[model samples]
Target chain A: MNLIEKYAAEVGKYLPSRNRADIEAEIRSTLEDMLEERAQAPNADREALTLQLLKEYGAPRKVAESYGAVQYLIGPRLYPIFEMVLKIVAAVLLGVGLLGFGVNAVRMDMAGPALVHALGKLFVDSFGGVMMAFGNIVLVFAVLERVLPLSDQKDLTDEWEPADLAKEQDPDRVKTSDLIAEIVFTVIFLALFNLYSQYVGIVIFNDNQWTFIPVLTEAFFRYMPWINLLWTLQIGLHVWLLRKGMWDVPTRLINLAFKLGSIGLAYAMLIGPAIIKVNTESLAGTSLAEVARELSPLSQFILVPFLIAMIIAPVVEIVQTVIYLVRRRSSVPFPVK
Target chain B: MENDELIQNMVFELRRGIISIAVLSLLGKEEYGYSLLKALSDQGLEVDQSTLYPLLRRLESQGLLQSDWRIVDEARPRRYYVISPQGREVLAQLKKEWASMTESMQKLLS
Candidate 1:
């Protein structure tokens, strides 16, 4: 009711329901005692002064935060790691969510009228849970990492000697050899998965036997049967890391390369044939007519970047990998064990 | 190791297990939140209430500590915590382990 009581209620609001009333009473008494002490001293407006004191101590949230250490899924000491995890989680969630929606729409549209309702139900039923489960697991792991941190940490509140605080930290870099193997494995897997799924969907569903063995499709799937080797390689790489008890600069660099390669492969799958068709048409016809006709109206704008993503983007990944590995490794201790 | 590193390591090591034991031992006698913290700190353990409170909540949630709020102070109600039967069993096992560890470490030091 009064200023002290108001502050008491505010603090109580943040506390657990069971403890609220008692904490509120305690806070009220404590504030009243403080106000009485303040009143004994000279103050212009005693009542207003009490209110000012309460405000300075801060609102309920600040008071509660002070009482409890500011905890996150990742604490302040490991915030960079937390932030990275958050970014990866958000990206993965967004990517998966979009993929689910795309798959749902495509599968729904593709189904015949007889199976339309059934297919729609089946697709939603199967994938909706998968997407939600993945998000939940990501959230759980993020929280776990925050709560049970894996990194070496120093209490932020500890006073530090400048020499100790400023001492150079030698960071471990991701191993390049490990990364190369991972990337090679990942890219091959991605390329193969793309070719296989496309082959299966385009060929088997095309409802034609002869078209299934089309020279283009054969060349594509044939060139990349080891695509699933991505899975084997990734498992192997992780096993190796687990065994070695560390993954530093070189591995991260390779991972970046692999990611770039995947994006590149995706781009190639999207539009590589179009470019080939265009070039072949021009060569055969001795003119741009056939090429121009066959190329979609917006094809060049789309496919040029697609090609760049396929070729140049992987190169960018290599650069990013180098930069990331160099900076992070400089501070990290090696052999994470 | 030097004195500071040794102390630091000891503090960190104590931190890993002490909270569990302290909570168990505190609850072993009787269960009350602020009083328990005061008692521990009074005994020179000096644990922050911030850490103690959350640890209490976590232990309760994990079924190691059972708690219920009672209107004991008349003016202010408070939650009381008690070691569950299972918690007592765990505490006994932990005590045995601690004793053995201390014995071994002392022997090695000697």
Candidate 2:
């Protein structure tokens, strides 16, 4: 093989399997073209010249970066947002997983093997699913970044003017107070999680002996740490939005929708069959289960409030996001602040 | 008045608001790595790559900047930076403060 062909094969090792051949062919052609140019030069040694060009062109890693996927926890373009989301998600997922493991271990000690196996499978499935989903998503985004051309490349048309670029920004950009608010909100979430944990301890676990109250309460408490982590990320998103000085109105609405969805889930947990047994046990023979079961399916009396809180609240939040986006856009400079 | 002392104070005061504003404003565009220093310097800020690069990283860790990389050519690549929304808002507010300070300075000098 020629000198150029040798270097091309070496660099091909780093590229994805699908693109490797094409990239190799491109590199091979380029190198051969370079070698032909040097063919007429006085002191050009083919082998040494090939190596010199490769060295200047960079190693396989650098060369591959040109055609490689965007770096992201879930994908290249989505990486930053994905990473921010992952830190929040992973912290919660792992914490919840740990709690699930603890609970299963506890149940194994106290109850039969059947329950233990069920809980174990659930924990494994949940944790494994989350991690796998994150990895797969990053892979997908990296692949997409390779395929997509979403970059801002307008500068190639016009050389950037040094003077205009260097002009100092008008003072009155960035507020420290916003950062402080984010910090304060995150601290509030942390504090609330601690207090809820303590409250669960007093009402359920502290009473000794496993009861329905403790079992269910522990489940909620186990998820509380995850809630705290979620809160931290939510605040982090706020901080990112503040710094970027631009808001995606739809994205904000989506966030509100998700928050409301979660609240809806909590409500479902409260009134659903799952809660009936716990409520009946905790509050004495009033048997909240029997009462809930007896209520008419068409009963809008209770449903109205629940619907208002869950469905209506999110709608209001979406409207608020739209209004906020419009207002901020008017006030803020573009290219993001 | 001492020329050196006056220049020193002027530099310090200019820096007082400028550094934070510049950092915040830069991050508002996109997340970046060490190139931030070069970009700043190329704009005539003359920030030390060592100091500015580390600070950019710190701000990112603090959740103010987001970054990613792109290849401009088949032979070379670079990481890009942008500012977060919160960083933008912060920049806006800081700009307000900076303008007011500049006005006050102008008044005093006049």
Q: Write the per-residue lDDT of candidate 1 for residues A14-130, one digit (tens) a residue.
A: 765765775566456545545655688664578787878787556677666644524455345434543454465457545754554454445335545634544344445446544
Q: The CA-based lDDT of model 1 is what?
A: 0.56
Q: What is the CA-based DockQ of model 2?
A: 0.02
Tens-digit lDDT track for model 1 on B59-95?
8778889887667646344567899998989899989
Error (Å) of candidate 1 at residue A142 is 13
Error of 2 at B61 (Å): 36
- lDDT scores in order: 0.56, 0.54
Over the true interface, candidate 1 deviates by an RMSD, in Å, of 5.6
Scored against the true structure, residue B76 in model 1 reaches a CA lDDT of: 48
A191-258, model 2: which lDDT tens digit per residue? 54564333221111112222222222444554555566666666666555544544465546546755
lDDT of 2: 0.54
**Candidate 1, residue B85: how far the Cα is off, in Å:** 1.2
